[model samples]
Structure formats: C-alpha cells, structure tokens
Target: MKAGTPDLATLGHRIRHFRGERGLTLDQLGELVGLAGSQLSLIENGKREPKLSTLDALAAALDVQLADLLAREAPSPRAALELELGRAQASPLYQSLGLPPVRPGRGITDETLAAIVGLHRELQRRASEAIATPEEARRANTDLRERMRARDNHLPDIEELAEEQVRASGHRSGALTHREVSVMAERLGFKLIYVDDLPDSTRSITDLANGRIYLPPASIPGGHGLRSMALQAMGHRLLGHQPPASYDEFLWQRLQINYFAAACLMPQEASVAFLSQAKKEKRLAIEDFRDAFGVTHEAAALRFTNLATVHLDMTLHFLRVNGDGALLKGYENDGLPLPTDVTGSIEGQWVCKRWRARRAFEETNRTTENYQYTDTPAGTFWCATQTGRTDATEFSITVGVPFNQAKWFRGRETTVRAESRCPDESCCRRAPDPLAERWAGQAWPSARLHAHVLSPLPSGTFPGVDDAEVYAFLEAHAGK
Candidate 1:
C-alpha cells in the first residue's frame, strides 16, 4: 500500500488475532471459505476488498454474523456521510422517494442532484435537532469558547453595563453588599428566596412568570457567591434573552449571565486599577485579589484572566479540576498547549497528577496555596493552585503563566520542578520502570474515573428543567 493511505490495519490485526484464537492457519481458513490461500491472505491483510458473497462465506467459516465482520470503530463524520449518500443513491428507498436512479460513473441532472441532497440535508438536520447529549453540550461549549477567543474573551457591552450598575449602587470600590444586591434585584422586579435544599443538579432557578429567583443555602453564605447568583438571575431579565432553543444556546446564555455577574462583582475601572498596581509591585496574588474583592478564588481567577489578558498585556491559563483530576473547566489566552481529544473538549480529560492543579488535592492544608514549576512541550510554566471543597466534590482553582511572564507573580519564587508528558500513557497512566520496581502496584493511589466522561449530556433546554413544575407553580400563584 502507498504510505499514509487509508487501509484496514486494525481489521487486519483483528482477523489475524481471531484466526490465531481459533487455532487455524490462513490456508485452513481459505480452505473453509473455498478461497485460495493467496486471495484470503490479501483480504486479511487489507490489500483487497472482499465481495459480499465472500464476506458471507468467511462469516460462515468463522461462525459469526455478517454484521460482526464489519463492526468496529466508526469512520469519521464526513467519510460516513459520503458512504451513506453513496448507499442511499443505490437503495430501494431512493426509488420509493420518487428520486431518479443514480448510476456509478454517470452524471445526473443538476436539479435532480440538488433535490436529493436537499432531502438528505433536511433529514440530518432534523436528527440533530431532536436530542441533546453531553457530547453535544461539550461541542456547543467548545464552539462558544472559540467565538470568545476570536474576540479575545472580552464583551464591552456587558462589561459597560455591569460597571454602570456597580457605580450606580456606589459599590465599585468594594464588595457589593448582600442588601445592595437584594435591593438591586427588587428594583429589577425580582424576589429572592433562599432554600436549604436545592437540587444537586442546579444552583439556582428562575421563576419567570412569578418574577421569583430561588437559591440554595450553600450559595447564600459567601459574600460573592450569593450575590453572584442573584446578579446572574437578574442579568437574564435585564439582558432580555428568550428561552434557549438548543444546548449551544443554553450554554451561551449561561456564559453571558456569568460574565455579567463577574463584571458586576468586579467592576472594570477599579479592577483594572487594582490589578495594575499589583503588577507594578510584584504582588499579584489570587488570594489577595479574592480577599480584596471578597470573591471566591475561582471567581478571582476568572476575573484575572478577563482583565489581565486584555489590559495588562499578560497571557495566562486558568483551570478548575475536581479532586479525582477531571478538568471541570479550562481556558488559555496564551499559546500554551492544552490537551484535547479528537473532538476538542478538555472538560472531562484527566490532568497530569504532577501538575500543580491536580497535585493540590494531595496537600494536607487545602487553604495554603500550592505553587510549582513545570515543564511541558509548550514551555516552562509557574503555577499557583488553591483548593476548595463543597458538599459534592473538592476542586482546585489554578492560574499559570509562562516562565518568561512568571516574574510578576509571587509563585515564581518556587524552586520545585516537575515535568509533564501528558495526553499519553507515560505521563500518568503507566509508571516509570524505577517506580514500577519499587511501589507501582503496592502503594500508588488509583485515580477515580469521572462519570462525566461517560454521562450523556442533557437533551434540549436545561438538562433537568421541568415544564410540569413550572405550570404547577404558575397555577398555584394564579390566585395570589
């Protein structure tokens, strides 16, 4: 075969393995299938395509169904689409659909071809529109992230609105008080209700008809947490977003609200000023930023990425990972390499344990920020990580800068160094020979596989929103 050409290397290996498992030589298999040894070998080695009759004969010889011979890793989407289109043109269904027959090496009229393609496109569109999965959600999220990157992750309109709200409330210089946030919601025609038990799947829910925003108690205590939730809920009303039609719209809407909330909590002028001073003094610490603004570490890290990348001429990577090491969220305006699967999602991939983000989970003191120096294929980076635990899981909030840009951060002084060769087995999955000889299987902690990797994403608007509950609530308040 020509180099770099498509071939059935995996199928050839499977055929050889199955043949060996059956304790039969190629000649014996050829004899059973009534084919010469050379022809059978060519088929086994993917040098030639087999006819359906030959495949059926081979299946019978192997005591398996015809479908079993063809089932394996699926082809790419474009390849699969082409294959389906080719099959459809020759199918009886095409004739039933009143479409003209398509013959190989023959040209059809342009109008007829257009009609067939239009019909196929409509069917594929309808199929995609019906159900939503986690994969779909991730794809949607990735798409939105790319859009944001194109704009450098800055939204001037939303930021201006948030800053105006902050300045009007007279809290631009300090943390927005709970009373101030409640009053702001009241002014925006929203009533806030705090509950002790909220569904694990949701942090807050908005009753649009009743103008009531419900929040869980866990989200109520923090100076920033409750306020952020309230602002996000109010933001939807102020921003005039309609009900989302797809998972992509749902994520984009949620992201818009989150950005509005962050901007409200950390106003533009004051935040940029504070960050600028910190950079000049070489005192840019995430915890200090959190304490100064009375926000969570995650919130501070997010705001840092927003402002630093735009105004301060700094590039950074922000990451959030669970204790089990699955990346919950990540972004890099810098050119640092982030691991992504073939579909370009980083959410459920495991982070290298040697990296500060994953290693923070092992610390005895989660409050103390962990710092480390790391070398990656991209370059050397200095990272700062802080851990936060909730009722559900422990998460590490991490911020990292390239080695050249690390001097402005306090964590740059760390002497610790580790190397990461991730997105590969040698990094975390397999052990080095020296460690394998010592304590590889004996004392190493087994990483927990996150279910998000396997869990199907929700179909439709909001994963678990109940239309029936909404109707019931509306009816209950009808007479009130």
Candidate 2:
C-alpha cells in the first residue's frame, strides 16, 4: 500500500489468517469495524490503503496487535534497512525527484528516512509506474530459486501433465516429431502460423480467443527452439496460468511453461533412462543428450539441471551468457558462487573471462564444447560450454558441476584449469602486471556498457510488450 513500508502483502496475509482463525467473514469484520464489506475485502487483498484508525479497528475486531500483523522473523534490522534502501535507490520516481539514492550503512535520522519513503510513494503515484528494478528482479529470482530448491527444481505436476500429453499424442518418449507436435497443437485447439517478418520483440503470440499462434521465422524457424516455442505456447494455454502481474511472477510462469515444453519434447522417463545409461557408461555429453532428445544444447543443459539435480543426485548450475559476458539466465541449486553485488543482482554481471562460459566466446572450433576446471573461493568446479550465434548476438550456454562430479561427464579429461575470484578484486580480470607495466600509458581498452546490461526489465505482459498492445495488434492482424 505504501512504498518501503513493512511488507503489506505479508500483513494482508496475516490479516486474512487472523480473520479465518476467528471464523470471521469479510462482512462480519466490516460490520464489527463499521466498514463496508468491499472496503474490507480491498484492504485484505492489499489493493487499498487503510487509515491508521481503520487498521486499529480491524486489529480490535481480529483481537491481535497491529505489530503482530507486520512483524517478519528473518532479515535482520540492517538487512531490512538495506532492502528498503535498495528499493529507494532503484525508484525512478526518486531519481526524477532529484533525491539522493539511499546507500546501505549510511546513517540517517528517522525523520529523513520517513521523508524519503514518503517521496518514493508520492513519485509512484505521480508516475503510475511499476517498480520493477534490478533490486526487485534479484528479489524475484531469489524467491523463485528458493521455491525451486524446496522441490529440488523439479516440477512433478508439469512432468505428469507432459507424460499424459505424450501418451495422448501417441508418442511414447525420445523426441516428439514435428508432425506429432502439429497434431498436439491442433488437439490443444491452436492453429500455428509462421510469419517471415514478425516483430523482433515477439517470438510467438497466442491469440487464445481465436486459437492461433503466430511465430516469427527468424526467432524460431525450425529445430529445438521452434518445437520448444510451440509447446510453450500450448503450455500456457493448457496449464491455465493467467498472465503474470509482476516481473517475478512473469519469470516464474515462463519457467513453468518452459519446463512443461521440455517435458513434452523430452519425456522425463525416457530422458532419465538415457542419462542413466550414459552415466553408467561414463559418456555423458551435452551433444549426446541434444542428439538423443532432438533438442538444442541449451534445452538439453537446462533439462539436465531439472533431472540430474533431482534424480541423479548431482548438484549443478546452468548459465546462458552473451559474447559480452553478461549472464542472460542462470540457475544453481548447488550453492555455486555467482557474481553479485551486495544488492544481489546477477543477470547482468560480467562473467570472469577465465571461466569456461566466457572462454566459449573465443572458441574457433564451434563443434567442440569448451571445458574447464575453475577454482573459486567455494571450490573447483568443472564446466562445459558450447557457443552459438543468434541474429542479435553471439552467446554461449554452459553447465557446470563440482569437481567430484566431473567424472560423470564426457569432458572430465580436459586439462584446462584457471583460478577465479569473481566479484572480488585481484582476479584474472585485472590485466597482468607485466603487460600493464610494459604498456601502462600506451594502451587501454575503452569501457563501454553492454547494451544487454542496460536493457530494461521485460514488461509484465508478453516478453517485451504490454498485453493490451499485443491484443490490439492481433485484432488488427486477425484475418490477414
């Protein structure tokens, strides 16, 4: 309800919990508080701000102290203050108002702090903007990662649905053929359309009301990406998930659909059997998985994270990075140390040049997967990376496991090794002292921000556009 206020979402949940505990309905609570049922419902849903008097009345009606509704057990006072400070720093409205960004560990009076937060709320109201920032994105990633870790990053529900989909389509595993995928889409009631000149921002658009899926020839022509996109579109339709209301929810929903798509492309039972056999023979390779499952290396790498972590009892991490070394996507359940500032941002941080993922960019041999063992503060991790070029950028997809688990991978015999102290100074990122001494004043590399690093957060609707615009465009292009 208010910017930088103690989590109102949590407070609202507590309010609902207390109301249910006391066996009170919204109408009953509203009556007791001399408020309307609609107002109470809005307050409970966190859609409306309640006056202090109203909160007091609701507290009285619920027989709980207001503090009980707002208290959070974790996050030390310093940490909580830092989180609030981050929200303020990332606030565009705060920036527009010419207010100084709040820095953690900076002492401020309660009066100053309240004023800053008040201005933040006022700015939000004036701008009518969604507060999606790097800080919020990191928080979202952390929340989703926690949920995935709780379930070992495996979705049994989606897996079951995928298996059922396979059986219904008369395809019992391995790889779903294009004809089978077409039949599956038809059965799901979506007519597929491929347009050679679809917008770059849109990969595939689902006009659910008309039951059509418009795909771009460039983004997904034919192969793993195409099938994955088709199944992903169908996934959104069949899984019954509403469009996301927040950036974090959008990311979570995307992953859910992608998991479903992967499940359909490579059924869990069959994939596991192949992976198990590969492991038994000590011949696990991304290429082998990709060929066997008829998916891209990226898909294979991600699916391996899903299954290997849960089924094979292997701790793993996956990363997709661009040529500029910015992490586009990453996930780890194995406590891998990734680059992050104190604010916990991850996606745009520069991957250490010495890491296998970064080395993939310089790789001339496109067919061979780059492998390396890198020692970190945590320990040595063996990673394999494959490079590929998209129309927009050249990128690499990498998967890594702890050194002990390297024996289970095909590239275990690689002699490449490097020491890394990422997110730390004095690592290989620093130019060698000898070179620096020789050319201290003669040479320098220009520092330029990678465009991806500066790219704005994807809209809550489709990947890069709002839902209304997408719908309107679809309406205009409906018949043509």
Candidate 3:
C-alpha cells in the first residue's frame, strides 16, 4: 500500500464512515453525487477510476478536502482538471485546499469535456441495456435504491408515485405537473408537494436541493382543485430508504448536493472565465446567454443566485414572494439576518403592494434588506446581476459572482440584465424510461442524467431496438 493512497479497501471503509457520520446511506450519497449506488460501489471497490468531476463530487459529498480523497503521491488521471488550481495557489488562501472538491464540470475543452461526458454516455448506454431485466434489478438493491436504480420503476400506484416524483423534481428547478411528475416519483418513494402553482410562489426543490417536501395548506388548484404547491413552500427531502440521523447532518447533505450540482454544471475555469467576461461586459446579458446556450431564462437567471463563495464577489439577493404580495424568501446577501440555507419572508403588505404595482423591487437600504455573513451558508457570495430575459418572458437570477477587481462601494441595486427563459419544466415522468431518451439522442454529460441515471457500467447494448426507432422522438421534436 502507498503512503497517501485512498486505496480501494480502506477507501470503502473511510467512505462508509464519512457517509455514516453524515448519516447518509449509499443511495442518498449517490443522489448527492448524482450517481447510482452500484456505480458508486464499483468506484469504492476501485474497479474504475472516477472521472475528475465524479471524484470532486465524492469529496463534496463526503465533506473531505479535495486532496484528502487519497494520500497518493500523485493525483488520479482526473487530476488533469486540477492543473490550474496550482496557479490558483499563488494566493495563500486557496493553496491548502488539500484536494477538497472544487467543481470541475465545464472548463475542459469541448473535446475533453466530451470525453468525460462520453463516460456518462457509456454509463447511460449500459443502463439502457439492463432496463430489460427489471425484476433482477429489484433483487439486487434496497427498495428505494432499486427504484432509483431501475429508473424504470413505474408502477400502478400513480398518485403515490407522482408525489415521490415531485419531490425528486425538487432536485432541480422548473418542476412539472403533480400528475406528471408523481408517476415518476411514486415508483421510487420520492415525495413531492405543491403550494400554489400560479406564479409558483412556494418552496422550490431547486432552491433546497435536498430537503423535505413542503405541502401548502391550500393546493394551487384551491381547496377542492388539483394538487398545487405554492410560494413559501418548504420541506425536507425523504431519503427514501436511508433516513438521516441528525438534523444538522441532513442539512449538510442538502448543501453538499447543492454544491455538487453547481460544480458539475459549471466547470471551475469556465466559471471564472465567465465572471471575468461578465466583469468586462459590466453585467451578463440574458438573451445572449439563452440563444448561445439553449437554456431557459429561469435556469439562466437562477444560475445567478446559485453563485456562492466558490468564486469571489459582492453578494446579491432574490425576493421569493407569495401570490398575495407577501415576501417568503427575503432578499439579502450571504450576510445579515438572511437565512444560511433557507428562504425568509417579507411582510404581507409588501406582497399586496407588489401585486398592485405589477413589478419587482430591488431592496437597497440595509434597513429593509441586509444580512450578515452568519446569515448565509459558509462561502457566501455577493454582487451578481439578473441574466434571464427575453422579448416576452423573464427570469430573475439570484446568485452572485466574484466581485470585479475595480468594484467600489455604491448603490446596492442594479438591473444587470434580463433573460427570456425557456419554460420547459422538470420532468421525472419516467415515460418510456430514461433508457428511451438515450436511444433518442440525449446530450452527453447533460446535468439531466439521461436514460441510465442508474445501473452500473456502460456495458450491454439495448439489443433488440433498432437505432432509427430508438431516436424517433428526438428526431420528431427536431423536425422542421
């Protein structure tokens, strides 16, 4: 055994230890790392070298320093992504990172990123093959784990499944209908609730990453209408099989996943590059972002709020509101009385006023909106701008970016930009199964986790299906 190597045997023990300390099971950890347990187990067994991003995720999920992943004299091949951190180390602050997980998702050349993405594609491809043996899958893993593992765990209990799917949909923003997403979640024991769907004023799964499902006293459709979730909605995520032991541990797990998604979606280099460019441009322009990247305005705008200490910058805030014009999640940087992880509320009168005005307000004075550092999660950020807007629709960006080198003290508010976000809602519909999507031509490494969000390796081809029919839906959607 080598001095610092996080060898397979000990690695598994340590991993299991860390996971237990956090009170997360293999399934929960996989969800945090955006992977399935089998694939993760294979990694634990040292059967495969984690792609750099996956390794970074494991670090975050485990709350270990990136370097602590192993004591190897040299880093894993995935370490290639770490090339720049050495340069980043010029400052004493970022130097002793100890291989802590820093998100390494996007910056690789499209080719390199594509290569890493190919690993996911292969993973997906293989899962598609296994979907055929649905029964065999159930026997291999725990109930909830099996459901997630199968990714095809659709069952007859539609309503129950929808609730579960809604909860999982919270894993991301833009949730779909309860009816639609439920089918997906129930099969897996996911729990989802809605407050009011109308401006979607409620707890957002995208906001919390991993937490309980919040159900409003009144559904969006009203007392007697369809199930609807609304504003100020908040809840804890049901870990399906493995329940967390402590509250802090649960919150920690949630933060880890939130960070993981951010890391995976935006690679380190590209993120900095983007900030620098945004700095040069003064603010990020929304339309340019959407057309350029094929993203919805809400996703783009929300991306702004997701910005945290991963980079340096002045903090910004988003005002989550209720239909009645009351504030649910307050507007504050990572500072002041603002929440460290959850959203706060505004006076109900504010809601009425806003509804009357039919507009949004930028709170500048600390009197109405200012939070202290402790008020936010560790590594809080500030100074970001809006980026999702189009000719008609608009999304509000909430996260902050690192401050500009020439930044100065002044008015706290800026329009920055608006993005015309795409309205495509999140779907765990489980229709045709994710296996179908791979056959239909999904983008590799798309944060969405294609057909094979489960299974183990990228082996086994979906033998019987013809490639042409496999991609029919995608082709049709692409049809002119």
Candidate 4:
C-alpha cells in the first residue's frame, strides 16, 4: 500500500537512521545515489516523497533493504522522540500558539527532546480537559453523532463480540436471563457481588485485581437495569478499554459500552431474524421488540437504529425527550430535522411542538404508543412514541422512519399528521403575533437552570466516579 503523510514521515526517519548508522554525510549519500544533497535533505525531512527508483538507489547506497528504509517503526529511541516532536510542532494545536518550530539536530540532545515532547503532551491533556465546558462538550457530541449517522449507527465488531459471548453463555432465545448474565460474567473471570453501599455516582464497579463486580443490593424495577449494568462493567474488559485520558475518549467509551450491553440483551442474529419476519408480516413495532428482548422502550428504540438500516434496508431516527421538551438523546440517519444548537448538538435542545416527540407529552393515553405522521422540510416521516417516567422526570421514547418505509410497521395507518419547519423561528419557537403582542413585556418568568449546565463535568480517570468511595468499598470487601 502507498504511504500517507505520517507513514512518509516514518519512512524518512528510517532512511535517515540507516544513513547515519553507515556514517554517510548527506552529500556523500547523494553522490552515491546520483541525487543532489538538497534533494536528499528534503527526502530525509519528509518534505518530499522519493520516487520508487530513488528509494531503491538510496537503500542500496546506504547498505539497507528497501523494506528497512520504508519500515513504520522509528529506527531508534532518539528518532522516536524526534518524530514525536516533529508531529507535535506540525499539529494545529501547537501551530495555534504562533511559535516557531524547533528543528532536531546535533545541537538538540535526546534529554531536551524528551522534555519538549513531555510539555507538548501536557498541553494536549489540558486542551482535552478544557472540552468539559458545555459548549465544547456539545461540539464534541455533534462530531460523534455525525460519525454514527455516517455508519448507520452499527458497530459490527462489537456486535460480533457480543454474539460470541451470548452464544457461549447458552442463551439462544428471548430475553437474556439474569442467570445467563452471571454465567457470562463467570466466563470472563468475574463474580457478581451485590452490596448496599455502592457510590452514588456509580451504578457498578469492577475490581480487576479481585475479579469481582460490585453492584447495588436493591433490585431495579425492570431487572434489566442490573443486567445491563453488569454487562457494561464487563464490556470494559471485553472491549479492552483503558482509563480515558480526555472527555472525548470518556464519551466514546461510554457509548461503546452501552452499545455492547444492548447487543448482548438483543443478540444481532436473533434480532435480525425476528425483525425480518415481523417486516414480512407488516407488523414491525418497538413494543414487540422490547417485549421480545426484555429491555426498556428506549433500548429497544435505540437498538432499532443499530439494525434497521443494516439488515432491513430502512433508515430511521430515534429520540428521547423530557416532558419539558428538552432532547435527552437523539440519532438519525434518515433526513428528519431534529432540533439542534449552533454547534449541531441535539441534546438539551428543544424538540418542535408539532413533532410527535413533543406532542406525545400532551396525549392522555399513557399506556399505549402514540403514532403520528410528520411532514418535515426534508420529507414526511411516521413515528411511534411511548411515554415513560422515572422518579426524577417524565420522558418519551420515539422510533421513526420515512413515510415510504412506514408500511412495514404496525402503526403505519394512523391518520394523525402534522407539519414542522424546525430550525426556523416561526415553527414553534415564536408565539402567535397576537399572543406575543399581548404578553411581550408583561412576562418575567423565572427560568429553571439544569444542574449540568452550571456544573463542570465530573473529574477523574473515569468521569463522574468518586474514586475514594470506590477504593474504600473495595478495601472493605477484599477479605470477603
């Protein structure tokens, strides 16, 4: 394969290393290879790519194989340090400082290079930590959402891993049982131990040294909560995740673990088979999927996004919105115009009142799913939303698809329809002119600020986790 910019840099470093080992000056090597000293310097500094013939000649002249000259590894420890410094200086983060690049040469000792690289790494760490701010976090989330949309929100590798583990645990059908989950944990060399004093910030903790997974003593209402938490804890080990060094990494790890848990709860092969048959019968519905998998409505809706496009050739979107209209979670590969901030993040933004996600809150029937067809600027979509509640807030989970593909779903015939022109101030953002005129200056409502908006993101190796409490819990249970 052809080398990219970073690979070219590695090749250049290898060539330079070979030349130095042979004690050949640039001019002498250039003379032997029939190239100018300036040309050779350009090749060694990674400023230019050498022709295949030129590489062969240089490799022969330096008494090394072409493969050796093209190797990706740094030729020496000092060369590795030099390469790191070069990359740091070339990065946009370092360039933003408006400082001149420092060239590595005889005058620069390895110790000095090490110090420079260390400082650059520290700068990068601080820069990453700065993203914990709300605006920055939104931008990061926006970027990650775009990545998911591009891939249809499917992770084949994680799916395969979950399938292998699930099959190994002897779970071949509906609703992975609590006993099966414990068996899977045992297969991974872990024992599940429920305790009453888990840190409030954490749902579960894994003591790697002791091969124990500590969870809450009380059973969660649905029973899936504890199962999901246990699988997520094992996900870290199964997925080979390390302590995240930045907010972006922390978010990514959380997403992966959540996906893993869902995949285990609803194994892909089984889910696809079930969904395929449902589609054939024109009865695909989130409620059936949720009941079949024994997961929450939100998990079933989110998992539909994972498989719908890949297996059923149906693009879809999902939304979890609070009763107050704030978007808690969202994903779309179809052209649904979910509300977004300037940063492109949908979370915490308000959903349009005309859309089913928000309108579901106004419905009186809380037991059954609410279905509607929305005509949006992008296209018309049919959605089914189910209202749910927790001790802290009331929310709704919605799964939707394009109008053309709605025929395969169970609620496609619903006559309820509406129009939305979101991102436009007139859609739901602005009140009617008469109402605005009547109430413009008279209203002085107090706004309720969410605690997350004012607080900085949780700080530590694992964000939001209280390390002291976790350590103490582990210490107390070590002898048990």
* Candidate achieving the largest TM-score: 4
The whole-model C-alpha lDDT of candidate 1 against the native structure comes to 0.76
Which candidate number maximizes lDDT?
Answer: 4
RMSD of each: 13.2, 14.8, 28.1, 13.5
Q: After superposition, how far is residue 301 of candidate 4 from its true place, in Å?
A: 0.7
- Higher-lDDT candidate of 3 and 4: 4
Name the candidate, 1 or 3, with the larger lDDT value.
1
In candidate 1, what are the lDDT values of residues 98-205, reduced to their tens digit?
A: 867443222655455556666776755643553566677778878887888776778889999898777666564678788778877877778788865445556677
TM-score of each: 0.68, 0.68, 0.26, 0.75
Model 4, 1-480: lDDT tens digits are 384323767778888888888999999999999989999899888888888899899889988887777777889999899889889999988997899999888998989889999999998877668448777778778888888888899999999999999999999899999999999999999999999888898899999999999998746578989999999999999999998877777888889999999999999999999999999999999999999999999999999999999999999999999989999999988888888877788999899899998898899988989999999889899999999998899999999999999999998989999999887889889999999999999999999877888777776557778778889888999999
Q: After superposition, how far is residue 209 of candidate 1 from its true place, in Å?
A: 3.5
Task: Give candidate 4 regions above 4 Å deviation.
Answer: 1-131
Better of 2 and 4 by TM-score: 4
- Please provide, for model 2 over 149-259, each residue's C-alpha lDDT reduced to its tens digit, 9 standing for 90 to 100: 778789999999998887888896567987788788889888878776455566788887888887766354456778888889899878888866567667788889999
Off by over 4 Å in 1: 1-130, 195-202, 217-219, 433-455, 477-480
lDDT of 3 by residue, 1-480 (tens): 345565554454455556767888778999999999888787654566677688688889889976666653223343422333322433343343354433444455545644644554454444444443323322322233223213221122322333344444443322233444344434334445543321222223222333224344342332211222221122122233123332323333443333232222332334446655765655544334333333344333333444422343544444444433334333334332221211121222232221111133343321222211111223323332232233654323323322342132121244232211111112112335567766666545637543532543221122222334324422442322
Question: Cα lDDT for residue 423, model 1?
Answer: 61
Ranking by lDDT: 4, 2, 1, 3
What lDDT is reached at residue 305 by model 1? Answer: 81
User: Model 3 — which ten-residue stretch has the worst lDDT?
Assistant: 419-428
Give each model's whole-structure lDDT. 0.76, 0.78, 0.38, 0.90
